[model samples]
Target: MKMSDVAKLANVSPATVSRVLSNPDLVSKETREKVMEVINKVNYKPHIVARQFRTKETKIILVVVPDITSAFFSRVLRGIEHVAVKNGYQVILGDTENDTDRELEYINLLLQKQADGMVLLTARQDKEKLEEIAEHFPMVLACEYMDGSNVPTVSIDNISSARKVTEHLIQQGHTKIAHITGPINVVLGRDRLRGFQQAMMSHDLEIDSAYIQEGDFTFESGYNQMLKLLALEAPPTAVFAFNDEMGMGAIKAVKDSNLLVPNDVAIVGFDNIKMASVIEPNLTTIDQPKYEIGKKAMELLLNLINGEALQKKRFVMKDELIVRESSELVKNMP
Candidate 1:
């Protein structure tokens, strides 16, 4: 019913109850737990508007994503929501659809005080502008980040992960390997491409310019790019797509061409989304901890909101290479 009722039920003063609700970190852990138990038992919901009026904060977080329809971003959103709800904050999704102007519009909410903080799933703005906003507002970058910026970020090392996946393909006795890259403009895309190159060069294999096609991390883009690779005079024996959607699209292209996966052309991908495992031929991919990245990003933003110092600006999470059916070919002859 009321916070006072909660306070009475918890046997704590009204001020203590307020502190526990508004600023749980300020209260003792035991006391905070006691207050929370009573509040939960009584089903007490705080007056959000009134609380905002008192604290000059909305307790609202805005998470901006480049593509809302993506399963990878959706998983990340779930993790962010889980943390936000536990900490008495609400999450609002801002789907930018890879539009820079639309992304800026969402950032305006943070500047206008409509949201207490923001977690940018991807940054489309210039580095200077992003730094300016991070300097003034509680913000953290998740999944994607800008180079040479001090903004707090939670992400896996795309370069290293990409290299590992490519090396896996190379080690399987495939010298002719192709890469379907993400948009080269994005940091992750560039890093992944660089890693692919690194692996090829290290193995003394040459990368044909025609074998490299850029995709927009979409199913259509992947599908179209694979067709180009398939039409080449000397098509690659194996392919590595920057993301799983592209990998699946490539598999489709291969099938339509009357070729078999791994038998004719092995394939690998990044971001081990749910569909990767369920596909006709399970995709071998790099598993980025998307949900964990989202959770850590929110935690970092909360620290910024509370004026707590972060131990580090860059939060590099670990990634793993998952071997699956799509790239299961073992070449008996090179």
Candidate 2:
């Protein structure tokens, strides 16, 4: 039913009904109770579209992810949505497909008042443009961070996590460990690569140039890089992939070459995605708390949107190592 009908039935003007709906405290206690009763009786619904137009606040938060198809990102999205819905806010998702131009375009949409704030999964973007957008908007970085910027970010310690993974390989008596990673432009990729290098250097292992390969964090890239590594004169006895997809690809490559995992060449991957457990060999990788990261990022963004003082500029989540059949140490020597 219309607000006019409710107003007439409640013995109040339309303006009074509107005020009660928007801010009940502004109306008298008796009048507010009466209006609410009428509203309940009629099951009256206010025109949120018009109200949003008038207030210029849509109460919507936009989440821009680099690859929405990744199980890793899906979990993160769920975390953000859960906290957002609990706080009486709506979330809109945008997948940029790792395209810098598209990412920038999505960020530009915020300027048109389509969304009140943004949660970005970092991709390659113009730093100056991002800083410009952040000046007037509430934004949080999830699963990635930008160096030399004060942007609020929630992510795991990639360097330490990668080092741990490398250390595990070392403990397995695998001295010739190879590393595959994503593009160096992204923070996570660079940090993980650095972690791998640091761990090798600390152990006095030569950081062989030929043992490192770069991928685009894609399954195909992983497969291709693994093939290239396998073609080397002395293939690594163990391989470390930056993410789960690449690690899976590496597994496929190894199988195609008629080699056994952990026996001929052990493999470890990052991002303990759900499929990691169900896969044939089961993946050994770093377990990042994707859902918690998303939840915490949204909570921080909501607080910032509410003009609350933020005690910290950045937040780092911890990572865990899950050993599986894929990276089991070689037992018997031929």
Per-model TM-score, in order, reads: 0.89, 0.92
| Range of the 10 consecutive residues with the lowest summed lDDT in candidate 2 | 122-131
How many clashing pairs in candidate 2?
0
Instruction: Residues 1-334, candidate 2: write the lDDT tens digits.
Output: 8889999999999999999987788999999999999999889998878878888878899999888888789889999999999987899999888888888888888888788899998746766667777767888888988876677889888999999999999999888999998898888889999999999999999878999999988888889999999999989999999999999999999999999887988899999999989887999999999999999999999988888878987899988999999999798623
lDDT of 2 at 240: 96
lDDT of each: 0.92, 0.89
lDDT, candidate 2, residue 277?
90
**Which pairs of residues collide in candidate 1?**
none
Best by lDDT: 1
- RMSD to native for every prediction? 3.6, 2.2
